[model samples]
Target: GAGVSQSPRYKVAKRGQDVALRCDPISGHVSLFWYQQALGQGPEFLTYFQNEAQLDKSGLPSDRFFAERPEGSVSTLKIQRTQQEDSAVYLCASSGGHHSNQPQHFGDGTRLSIL
Candidate 1:
């Protein structure tokens, strides 16, 4: 596929453990987004990146979450001190344009479970 790709299709973490999720967006994509989706709810934005710059991160639940796209390509999302409440599907998406109305391409999320 020519769209975004995410790794570790599934993850199980013990409470308090740290984990990292990876996302590889379509080549040349300029905008990237990370979202958290809980069961029975819609995906909630976690962060946004334009090229190599992190433009927004207000949606991140807490300081334990972090994301980066150092090379304006592959991105990584890290979560520390995982809690049961943190269990959710982490989604990654990318868009070819910078405009807010641009349609984003999404990757199958990494489902994380905290025990």
Candidate 2:
């Protein structure tokens, strides 16, 4: 089966612009999650979706960040009004369990830079 994948592995955006990063989770997986990692820091939970239903989004940093999983398989993360502070690696992961303890397999991530 296919493993999780993300687009543009790297992105450079000007402040105030909007950017959308895509994630394709492993085939047949039931749960997906998004996380943000800044330099020298651990990944922070952003949002989660279970088969097209967003179960948790409490980790979203601000209103400028939005995510979705329309088909339960593929997901997208969109950031509005990009800022220098928004620069980071956006990782996506997938798991088979419903409980939060399920370990996730992560993609390399889309590194975004706001210049």
Q: What are the TM-scores, per candidate, against the unseen true structure?
A: 0.96, 0.95
Cα RMSD for candidates in order:
0.9, 1.1
Minimal lDDT window, size 10, model 1: 96-105
The digit string of per-residue lDDT tens for model 2 on 2-98 reads: 6899998999999999999999988888999999999999999999999999999999999999999997888999999999999999999999866
Expressed as tens digits, the lDDT of each residue in 4-53 for candidate 1 is 89999999999999999999999988999999999999999999999999
Best by TM-score: 1
Candidate 1 pairs with clashing backbones: none
Give the Å shift of residue 65 in candidate 1.
0.4
Please give the clash total of every predicted structure, in order: 0, 0
The list of candidate 1 runs beyond 4 A from truth reads none
Quick one: how many clashes does candidate 2 have?
0
**Candidate 2 ranges beyond 4 A from true positions:** none
